[model samples]
Target: MGLFDSFSQIRNILKNIDLAAVHKLSQKVDLNKLMGTVSKMSEEDLAKMLKFMQAGSGDKRPKPEVNGDFYDLSKTLSAEEKAIQLKVREFMETEIKPIANEYWNKAHFPMHIIPLMAKLDICGLTYKGYGCAGKSSLLEGFIAMEMARIDSSISTFFGVHSGLAMGSIYLCGSEEQKQYWLPIMQRMEVIGAFGLTEPEVGSAAAGGLTTTCRKEGDEWVLNGQKKWIGNATFSDITIIWARNPEDNQVKGFIVRKDNPGFKAEKMEDKMALRTVQNALITLTDCRVSEVDRLQNANSFKDTANVLRMTRAGVAWQAVGCGRGAYELALKYTMKRKQFGRPIASFQLVQDLLVTMLGDLTAMQTMVHRLSQLQDGGDITDEHASLAKVFCTLRMRSIVDHARELFGGNGILLEYDIARFVADAEAIYSYEGTKEINSLIVGRAITGESAFV
Candidate 1:
């Protein structure tokens, strides 16, 4: 037969068992029983069906594009913003994806990736001047999501540096301080870390900072310990928040790496975000020069302002983590076979997958608008707090569902969902725990603060 005749002959056979027919049969047959029957089919029948299935797919398999953005929220961004978003996505997939699990498993920071990441020029994305791109808050949120999609540890590391540490200065530092540090930090030449949560104080950091800062003639003597400070072990500069002994007001200082009495011990055996170099920082009469004091950070209110801004980005990171896990689970289900059928062909499995996608979509849409409010300058403490609470809650649910879909492989780090499952816990508790953030929104909208 001629090539065209053979092709036409195959097409005729393909039409007999196309995806549409298979989908209909799947609905009529009990998935478990149907799989058993397919497994028992004769070799000739199995081969013919497999060939028909492939041929029926033609050039387009009609596979649903694996996406967590159910409502297409990225459509709201402008073309330029979308381009930047895609650029960051490509960077994460190309640079971070391969090394993410390895570094995360070893609990080691990949130092070499820093300069490559810096070349992307995404740090201080929303800030204007100081060689920044001056993009909107939405773009920043997208970048956070992109990073977390591949590796949440890298996202958290970047967030601690660019959002919290750099933002603290951008929002509160004096003009000279801004001119001095913003440019270097923006270029990622000088990495940063925020030291706010102390060993004794976690969620209560606003009201209780055990770390004390006493002023001397030319420097501030800092004494106290900071716990779970991301990137602290090797960050070039750490923003240490401590209560002033004289005034009882919280203050911030740029604690340089070479401070004589400063020590940062790597926090080991973290179940989540292992790639992040979280440190239990110790300061024994660590004297930071007066020039290093954040001139405008007068109180805990200043610290809260920085947290308020970064909390929204954390919400977006949760979305990314959830979305990444969901995509992995969905793709696995579509390919993983049991008996003779893909596990995704089962109704119950599809239900779980759809549920995960729903949660992922909700989280994405919520953060999308949250960033919009921030860019509009209409964002309040409650606006960000609410997003943090909602998105993290949904993220927890999505990760759970995705993990369940993976069966035993879900717990295996090689599957990737295991990392998301563990990392989601840290994201849920960090910045502000769900309870703390909920009270913030409660105080704003209801005029009653339940927090004691």
Candidate 2:
């Protein structure tokens, strides 16, 4: 064969080799000596070498993004609600997004963010009085969704304070109690926690009140343990639900942190929603004045009323989580290239993205109606429970599909889906488990309570 033909054959062979390996090879080879040798070659030989280098280079092209909420649910809200939603989104993206993983990893709550979050003026968003905004329940649900989309732990923190704890007082507290606590709590100057679940009891908190309270002169003595109490560790006050010994009826008390017998210890090493400051609270001879007891909370039925409202918020939170996962996965798929094209363009990948969006949209719509029911004063426990059960179940499925789209990167915290995947577990269990909430609906339809 001719020498020129031999050189062309060699260049064709080198083009199949990896450019990264070739660069490494070039580094070891004396570039001056190599250049001296290659400079003697014809221009055609250099062109072939350049072509080989270009062909051997690995792809570094950008991928497309995958976003859920294709229907633009935000547009369904009023212009005012939409603006507030955007503000919340911006806050989550800017403030919470950066530190979420870190706090989650360490299982620590970011107390400093509480003051800043309160400044957003979103607490008691749906309540009509007691220094509240009196916004629509839809707006409140959307705000919960926005917070949870970025970090469910933070959302839980807010929900416990704004929804469960403060809501309990708003819905059941007397006018005097409202005047005393609502304004400070609205400003987040006094953080609140809800103590409902116990170490041995969770979903059965209703009709299974192990915590006991007794009247002693003008004060109520409380004794029991509460587990998984979010925001309890540093909360200014915790709403402790206990059974009144005299009447055997469930009652609510505003247990201040400095109360001599109120002890709250931080629960450690949680795998999901770790950024929330969960506490295992021990109330031994805790003294709460009769005036601090929620006057309107006559029974466990009243407590369920609070859960009904917060459960709807949980449904919205689930939608936010699914939306976040879908959006992140879709974005990753579009940008991550394989086989010389974006993965998002692949059929199977598109299938997953579409499925996630469908679930997200379903969840969003379901919660929208739920909020409407709440606003119209026709919301039932079954309504909120059904939404909670349905949305959270779908959310788990959506996050799993989203993680699948990320391939190896799906498991990494930096990708964002990992947090959603983890947070979904807590969302699934808290407020009410799938079984508990399902039975709440089951009791409504079948007229039978299956909960043992």
Candidate 3:
């Protein structure tokens, strides 16, 4: 090898030494004098000394936790919030990690784990009563990130039940309705789903829901199709939104699964988020009792209230997926060897890793502030829309960069990065598409409507 290459190899070997060993060595010998003596040695001699040091120091220092929270955002959380964050992380790593890929590959939900999840007591976590935790939105966002770090589909399943479906009832349901449904759903005894996106209306759902509702004496009949209803296939209840035919205004109803007119079929053959039980729902003459209608959800604006909260959850999910991918890449680079050294020892590989970490830190800090706004009651639709748009875009980029770091193994599901790659796409499209979310912010800032 040339002299330059020899010097490079010597530097690489020295960089891998555990720093604690150097500290201990300073106590035994004068570090300054020792370094001065070493300065006269050739690269070959330096390499020999490095091997000796490494052999002695292998067990002396523990590597830091493989984390993507570059700015330590979790530390900013209160003690209770921090505890809940760790609790959820432990749960995901212990329970979900083992079966996440298996369930994803089979496109099936693990129904048996529901009880274990309920014991976590996280459903409807942000609401005040009905056995809910009444926690701040910041805690809720961190918990969402923890779950997505392990599995995005499971996070989606929880977000729909806790944020969207339950939030609708909590925000718009009558006092009786909240008392009746919130307690059971909070315990997850009754699973919930949200049905708002339709086959023809996704980004245009605000003004374009094809579903219609008509009041007939004591019952209101609903007729329409809802596509991509999360948790609906086997959920005990679903929150369906339809337009009032008389006034052209939107309304919400809590539709029980076994209602004669309610039908849900599992959507099959998905490329991403396969473990989430998304369903195609048909409400044909679906008769809902007057009492079942959300007492306060008289207009589409009520629906927007629920979406505003859930959109933040989506942004946090994107952060989790990106964080998971970046950490996986970091771990892989440390072990996978290319030229008699770990790939991570190379400078170019480290540059990529740093870039991933930078993007992840930005996304993490952004969501942290978003959650704060939500808890402080200062959040707007535009606040959530900005995060939903920017974070998901950064998340996609992080996953792409992480996948490239894995090289050929990136495509293999067994290695884990492949799952994050596929699942991030699902988070990207759900909640609100990038274009739709951008317009929400656009209209807020410029006071001009760009949405068509």
Candidate 4:
């Protein structure tokens, strides 16, 4: 071939090769000498070289599926349970995921989606009667995971309604109260909130609730403030826990939203879980009928029963948050190119991904066993507390690593990883902080009370 004709053919061949590969090749070989060698090559040899270059120019293997469930724990669920899990997942992806960042950014609750969520018929999932599904706690845990996987704030709303509010009525209310409230709540017609944490009391709520309750004739008066009450701003009814001074024992009262003396001001400017409408509740001489009083909840121990059950669900939520962040980071790394290749191809990136997966997998399996214990009716305060402590702590780490993987974009809310990072902070602190939960487990193992 003529030298000009050969150079023309080589230019065409080089155009098809990856730029990064060509750049590397140029760094190693003398371009002038390579051209001289190529100019003398036969047409058949040139074609073979083109084929070899094309073959080695870029990755050709099919990419691995981005799944955080490395152990496939969902397979252990029954077919029916799996269906419910997938249904919730689909709902979150379709309805919640698109608006998650938007709503989270605005720090506003998506009130319009509540009706859509109600249609799932998952409210009061584990309760046996009063319009509940009577499903296993394992199924309930999966549902929580699915919801939080897409958005943690929505999960918190649902947990407050179904797990805490309805749970109080189911566990501590009179038979009449359960029969009356659970059906409407199950239908999502009457939203509920749990009011336990006070402005001055959170971890010390068991023994130091300053909110006072007094019984007078047929009306019981509740006078106290509750802080950080999720769903309180819009909840139809709130289960208010207050100290009855006469007995010095904590008691629960179902306070209606329209009561003249009850006011719930939305707590604003939160850095985490912004979509949740947490409230600073003020109960100035709020009078409830004797019938509204929780007949079975005579003391804080009854309240703790509700907390023990809900805390296990919180652990599952941490798994969901971590799972979401890990999955997002994994997908981002595969698409985000560095040095003309997917960052996922690099050793350090893979190492970080594996570390996140390890923490996520461990969190999932721990919550899986936690739900099993709950299903078998063998759950304890320490059991739930231990899961909550470990899972939330690991969730914090996973989100941190995920944010790190995104570099500067991690802090920008548009990337969604930023939301996971901020939300993880709230989960780490709420539903009983790590210190309190650890002490619970510590007390269990050592048989020694650490609270002074």
Which 10 consecutive residues of model 1 have the lowest summed lDDT?
Answer: 1-10
Q: Per-residue lDDT tens digits of candidate 1, residues 1-452?
A: 34444446545655765688768877997867965776677666766765665665554357888887778888889999899899989999999988888999999999999999998889999988877788999989999998899899999999999999999999989989999999999999999999998888998888889999998899999999999999999999999999997899999999999999999999999999999999999999999999999999999999888988999999999999988888889899989999898999899999998888878887888888899899999998999999999999998998999889899999998889999999999999998889988999889888987988
lDDT of 3 by residue, 1-452 (tens): 44566556556655776688668867999967976777777877876775675566452346567889878888888898798889899889999999999999999999988999998889999899888989989899999999999999999999999999999999999999999999999988999999999999998788888999999999999999999999999999999999987898999999999988999999999999999999999999999999999999988999999999999999999999999999999999988999898898899999999998998999998999999999999999999999989899999999999999999999999999999999999999998899989988999999999977
Q: Candidate 2 residues 1-452, lDDT tens each?
A: 44566556556656766799779988899856985787587767766765565555542334433445576777888888888988998999999999989989888888788778877899999987878999999999989988888899988889999999999999899999999899899999999999988888786677787899999999999999999899998999999999987888999999999999999999988889888888999999999999999999989988988988898999999988888888888878878999998897799998888888888888888998898898999999899999999999999999999889898988999888898999999898888889888998999999987877
Give the winner by lDDT: 1 or 4.
4
In order of appearance, the predictions have TM-scores of 0.88, 0.85, 0.88, 0.89
How much does candidate 3 score in TM-score?
Answer: 0.88
Note the Cα lDDT for every prediction shown. Answer: 0.90, 0.87, 0.91, 0.93
Q: Candidate 1: what lDDT?
A: 0.90
- lDDT leader: 4
> Where is model 3 poorest over a 10-residue stretch in terms of lDDT?
54-63
| Model 4 / residue 325 / CA error / Å | 0.4
* C-alpha RMSD in Å of predicted model 1 compared with the true structure: 7.9
* Candidate 4 colliding pairs: none
- On residues 337-362, what C-alpha lDDT tens digit does candidate 4 reach at each position? 98998899899999999999999999
Q: Among all windows of ten consecutive residues in candidate 2, which has the lowest summed lDDT?
A: 58-67
